[model samples]
Target: MRYAYYPGCSLQASAKEYDLSLKAVCNRLDIELVELKDWNCCGATPAYTVDPLLAMGLSARNLALAEAEDLSVIVAPCPACYKNLRKAGKALEEDPELREKVNDMLTEHKLDSIPKVKLPLEVIASDFDWDALEVERPLAGLNVACYYGCPVARPKGGFDNREAPQAMHLLVEKLGGQPVPFAYDTKCCGGGIVFTRDEISLDLTAKLLTKAKAAGADCLSVMCPLCHLMLDAYQSQAVRRLDTRFDLPALYFTQLMGLALGLGREELGLERNMVAPFSLLERMGLKV
Candidate 1:
């Protein structure tokens, strides 16, 4: 099950832990990830707001590279990247004139055909045989709140339900972890405005933390790095702003899967998480 892997900008720097854990889990599942060489930024959220064509072209450039690689499917770990790539791919495939315009922007590589853009969750859920994989350490007593944030199940026609996604929940169940009934699973974490309007972002992040904690979730299983950053990295700020205690740990879903698969903490980059899950893991009787 080989697919083109695009780590995007966040995974290389702020979300290295996600990249590490994703690779570890993929390796364990025998899912080969051929990373596209010289892959550029997917333009994330900023470029599209500034100029729609520029955003499409930026994402289309990466798609052109994947087409060159002869891979039918391109899997992006970052939801923002996946959204951009998927949007651009669909636009290009539907409109020939738009494809020509974008191709003109690409001086070096022209997109003959845009590859199918997919989220890491989409690839993992559809490809693997869950029953065959041995679960060395089942997450028996752990309660996880799967957070999709925005962009993950958005823009419609994607893998999961845009309003009510259940892919992460099913994966949690498969890993022997109980998926808590979280109402704000698809809620925005204010990641788009975290830098410019931190007050608003903090308020939103605080609310999410509050809800997840209230739901009795031991930790938040997030798919997007931006969501993880707002929930985990900026949790202290959210706590200070709201004058509340939110000692919740935000972990990548891949990290949880790795732990259940008996992969060590070092391999899954567990130490890189801002909110430490050591105590939580200890409670689960799992080695950290």
Candidate 2:
């Protein structure tokens, strides 16, 4: 499968591992990703909240760029980017007024067509030939609590089931790992509230982590970098604030998949995460 890949702002900076691991996995899976040139941010939560048109305009510009490349499909690795882009494309695909307004904003890149925006997880789950896939090392006993994050299945009409998505579960099994079903798989992690409403965000994260820990998950396999920051980075602070002991490391699903594919830690940028995955994987009887 070939498509235009948009790494977004976070992937180029804080979430470089997502880019590396995703590209590596795509390569192994025979998926070609040609990056959309001069792409900009999809205007994530803040822009969408401030102005829906502004968000759609920004996301639409990227879609227009993909159209310039003669590409009809775009794969966004970030959940927020996927949501924003998919939302914009779907909106433009349906509403001509929004499409014209958005096309007007992008004088440089005209929207000749609205491309299909997709998440890597959905693409990989549906397209990748799991039966033909060969893993270097099987992750037999690793228990993973899949965290899809808020925007992933939100606004209710994306690709998969909003409330109870199983793409991650099936992917975990494909990697030879056990998927641990937990309560907060699709719960909100309190994005901006992390800084604005510290207590609320921390408490929410603590609650989610508590459930995953209770489920006997070795670590949480996540798709969104923001959720990784909240669940893995702020885990210690949340534990301290909640006065509870929850030691769970969160890794991108791609990182865990890379491990199962026998890729080295550094190659997948495993060390980029705030919560190091080495100890957790080591504890799972894997020689990390």
Candidate 3:
């Protein structure tokens, strides 16, 4: 199970734990992650808003680099990057004119070809040895609320189901953990507006957290760094602003999966997180 791994800028910097957890889990699962050489930013939301073609062109350049490595599938970690790459690939496949324009841009930039882009979660499930991923000491009593923010599984018909996607839920179940249903699983955390409208972002986050907590979710399992930031980092601020108390610990789906796979806490980079997971795991009777 060898594939090209693209750890976007955020994962390399603030989200280093994501990279560490992913590497550890992949190693344990016998999945080889070969990183693309000298990859650049995927031109997330900024480029798409300013110029769609430029965004596609930037994403296509990275795909071209992956093609140079003779890899068909690329595993992207960042949700924003995954959305950009997936959308660019879809746009190029659907619209021939856009494809030619992007290709022309690629030619101008001296990039050769484009390879298929895929999110790590989807790629792992689609093309991996599932039988080998059998659980050792599965999480029996843990309750997780699967949170997939706007970019990862939204705008409909990109990769998976948008409204009620069960990819993460299924993964949680595989670990013997129960995925609790909540109202705001697919709701936006006001990610793009976090910088500009802090109040609205915090309010939205607070609402989601409160709902998830009420729904009996001890921890919110996530896949996106941006969502993790808003839900975990801004949680205290959101609580302060709303004058409410919500101590929901947000864990990366991979991090929780790694723990279930019998990997030690250090391997999952649990210590690097802003939201302390020890109390949450202990509350669930999970040995941390």
Ranking by lDDT: 1, 2, 3
**Each candidate: what lDDT?**
0.90, 0.84, 0.82
| Local accuracy of candidate 1 as per-residue lDDT tens digits, 7-96 | 999999999999999999999999999999999998877899999999999998899888888998998988888888988998899999
Per-candidate TM vs. native? 0.96, 0.94, 0.91
Better of 1 and 3 by TM-score: 1
Candidate 3, residue 42: CA error in Å?
Answer: 1.1
Tens digit per residue, CA lDDT, model 3, 1-288: 888888999898777778889999899888888998888899988888898788888898888778788887788988888878877777777887777778888752433445666777776667776677867668889988989777555755556677778788888888899999876888998766899999899889888888898889989988888888898888899878767776788988889888888887888889888888888777666776
Write down the TM-score for model 2. 0.94
Q: What pairs collide in candidate 3? A: none
Q: Write the per-residue lDDT of candidate 2 for residues 1-288, one digit (tens) a residue.
A: 789999999899878988998888777778899998899988888998899888888999999899999999999988888878887888898999878888888888789788988888878877778887788888899988988877556756666788788888988998899998787899887755888889999888888888898898999998887887888778899888766675787888888888888887777888787877778777676655
Candidate 3 stretches greater than 4 Å from native: 94-104, 107-113
